[model samples]
Target: MKDVYGEAIFDFYKGDHSVVLTTHNTYGEPEEMPVEVFFRDHQDFTELENLAITSCEGKILDVGAGAGAHALFMQAFEMDVTALENSPGCIETLKHSGMEKMVNQDFYAYESKYDTLLFMMNGLGIAGKLASLPFFFSHCKKLLNSGGQIILDSSDISYLYEEGVAKPNHYFGEIQYQYEYKGKKGEWFDWLYVDSKSLVQETKELDLHTEILMTDEYDQYLARVTGF
Candidate 1:
């Protein structure tokens, strides 16, 4: 892997001035999106993101911490936060941006524990597929200290389909995505966007408790899961 996504982000962070993320998804036409790295400096955030960030406590791990935005925001409050990312280029960007703590490793492979596992911006997508939820929850369980919580956000995305249209046989939240930047393309990957109902059910199956913190008009929601 050449870290195509990371390279684009790095260029943007290094003052490229014209960088944008070209994203392709299974549900829609390709779109040119602003690099999230820029959002690090914005004071206004979505209600869901604000809820997740304000709810953080103790040692926090921001998984998939692209550009270290969420981690940086939490750190501003003097919270002990670590930005965990797999991209070397993004990690370098984090360091350059003055992120105090960082881990350049895949979330699943990292063994350390935390009081709060913060996953914003549909970070739960890392679960990849509905069937992988069990393993995902189990791994997160091992990574949490007693009384710790997983605060994350995701959207229903079922609205993407028309009323008369039939959805896929499997869960509708399972999505595929590919990245393109400066005429180069990246490999496609599965990304899950679980609805709150399914998420609560899965938490029950795993002996965890879940709460829907907030939901917006766009079908996006924030949730909190805690070990029993």
Candidate 2:
């Protein structure tokens, strides 16, 4: 991830600052610059979508572009890119780099459109925002050019509710279809919270099509906009 704030932190740590505010030490600090709580590393970081099988190039829309990493990545490949970040602070940072074109408006209000809509960083959670999935896809479908696709990231949690894996949950509300696959014991990830059925059913309701671009024992879905 292209973390501008990270660069600042490094500068502070390497320079004359005796005190630093990292995650572990933040609570002990008297003054601290606020950070985006959701900021984290992408274990399943999205690279170039298979160009031969999927033309995820040309005009691209990267929704919820935190810190503009996706935009910078696409720019390196020479694709036309536009980012939609609701946070004013993020937009300001995106402007500083001038890596790609961007929109400060909400994705719902985005009108310029694109040939591909990218929902990297576990956009399933945002799409699964309390029945907004359908509405979100509707807007994406309307925004995409013909043959455009919606590529997003998600994981399968069905294994979590399976018979046995070693550890057990605290029995939190009817099992709730948690993510049980993919991930070494100690690695961390962004919160997408998507499983196979929910991801498929929700997108299908919006008339979009999906495909499992790349996955492992645990599932991570990259859905496409099939113009439903």
Candidate 3:
């Protein structure tokens, strides 16, 4: 897969004020994703994001830590935080941002224990699909310390489908997307946006306890998962 996303991140970080990253969905329409969104500071975070930030405890792992925005905030309070990112270009941006600890490895493949796994920006979408929730939960079990919490946010996305609209046979939240930057496109990938009910059901089966921390006006929610 081409690192179109990383290139965009690096470009934006390097002061490319006009850099625009676009994502394509099944609808064949390109959705503009402003690269600067990843660079937002704490003041610019949404209510749900603020909840996720305050929920962090002990050693923290900022999963999919693009641009190191959240990690930079945590550092202000002398909080132990690590920025985990797989994008090489983003890694350069993180280094340039003066992050104390940054790891360049796939989330599931990285072995480490942390009290809080902060997944902002719908980072839970890394699960790819609904059927893979168990695998995602299982990996969280390995990465969390005893009584650790997984603080993340996700949207319902069910509203995208109408009452009588024809939907795919699979879960509606399992959306496919491709990133394009400067005319170069990356490979398509599956991203999940699980609803609250489905997320609770999956956690229940694994004996994990989930608590809804907050829900924004757009139906996006912040959740805390523990009892691992």
Clashes of each: 0, 3, 0
Stretches > 4 Å off in candidate 2: 1-55, 158-192
TM-score quality measure for candidate 2: 0.62
- TM-score-wise, the better of 1 and 3 is 3
**Runs in model 1 with CA error above 4 Å?**
36-38, 163-166
lDDT for each of the candidates? 0.87, 0.55, 0.90
How large is the C-alpha RMSD of every model relative to the true structure? 1.6, 9.3, 1.3
Per-candidate TM equals 0.94, 0.62, 0.97
Cα distance off (Å), candidate 3, residue 117? 0.7
lDDT per residue as tens, model 2, 1-228: 333333433333344243233321111222334333223333334342342114466688888776665676667667788878765656766676564588887676768767877776556555544255576677777888888877777666555446454332431111221111112111122233566566677667766676656665446555554654
Candidate 1 residue lDDT tens string, 1-228: 768789888998888868877889877789887785444564767777888888888999999988887788778778999999998988988999889999999888999989999988889999999999999988898889988999999999887777654687788999898899888888999999999999999889888999999999999999989972
Name the best candidate (by TM-score): 3
Which clashing pairs does model 2 show? 150-225, 157-179, 157-180
Error of model 3, residue 102, in angstroms: 0.6
Output the better candidate (2/3) by lDDT.
3
Which is the better candidate, 1 or 2, if ranked by TM-score? 1
Best by lDDT: 3
Q: After superposition, how far is residue 199 of candidate 3 from its true place, in Å?
A: 0.6
Which residue ranges in model 3 land beyond 4 Å of their true spot? 163-165
